[model samples]
Target: MTALIMLVFSLASLFMFPLMAQPLSLGLAIMISTLLMCSLASMMLSSWYGYILFLIYVGGLLVMFAYVAALSPNTLFGSGSPLLFFSALLVPLSLILYLYPLKDFSLMTVLSDYSGFMYLKSYGSELISPDSMSILIGLGTILLLNLIVVVKICYYQHASLRPFNEV
Candidate 1:
């Protein structure tokens, strides 16, 4: 359980690394972060949930990413120094974090004992429960809403998003 928490934090740091990047790179980072988070969730919770989330993120988000990539100005991003600095900073933080848990194994054991506990399980079986179904449906609805919002925001009339029609 401690390991899973550590893994999630590590993946979270991976997500933060992309904030220094351009939009395309940031989108890629977000996708990678989603994948890593999904994998971690799969390990901690259920494989199907993780798999479904990953698929939804990739399939639904890629179109929006492409639209932004096409519409956004191609600025020359040269933020290499910050990336290096973040790497140096994150490595020690992760190591220190990992060491902290090793010093307290009793807490880890207690957390592990409760790994199977979830509010949804209080309702019914995990696989076929209304909680799980609602979660999946909610995720899909959110993705659809996001897609619509992105499409709306990227109007062709907007100067930033408009394509050049001149020959």
Candidate 2:
């Protein structure tokens, strides 16, 4: 029940983010906050696997934030340059990394994933670039996976506690 509520709230916030009239910075802040809250909640409610996934998501957000902060807005989308190409390539790569986390998805994977997206859209344009969209979709997939793990854990825990319930 708690997991369901949290999932609903996070999904609602994620969708509602774009409809507000706030500045881009404010939107970023909201995204960070929402991500943090969801990550923490998942960590608390989930098993080891779910916790690891949440950590990866949190790490990705931080990295993306840093990359966006470090780059000059002009260079991000100025022209056909190496940085743009690298950033573009990084998006899919990060997604791949996130999906197949090495040694358990930690902060590093999260940071790399997010950073790649930010680098792709460092310019002062819209935030919803192709990379960003991919990231979002990836996140949604992770969330679903985490939820499944949580459900499985809950089922096993309950089963162990009430072995005779089936009878």
Off by over 4 Å in 2: 19-46, 72-138, 141-167
Instruction: List model 1 lDDT by residue over 1-167, tens digit each.
Output: 54445454544445354244355655655565566556754554467877987887887567767777777656567667645655666666676656664322343234336756554445535545432343344344444544454554455685276657897
Worst 10 residues of 2 by lDDT: 71-80
Clashing pairs in 1: none
TM-score per candidate? 0.55, 0.32
The worst-scoring run of ten residues by lDDT in candidate 1 lies at 102-111
Clashing pairs in 2: 59-110, 59-111, 60-110, 60-111, 64-114
Clashes of each: 0, 5
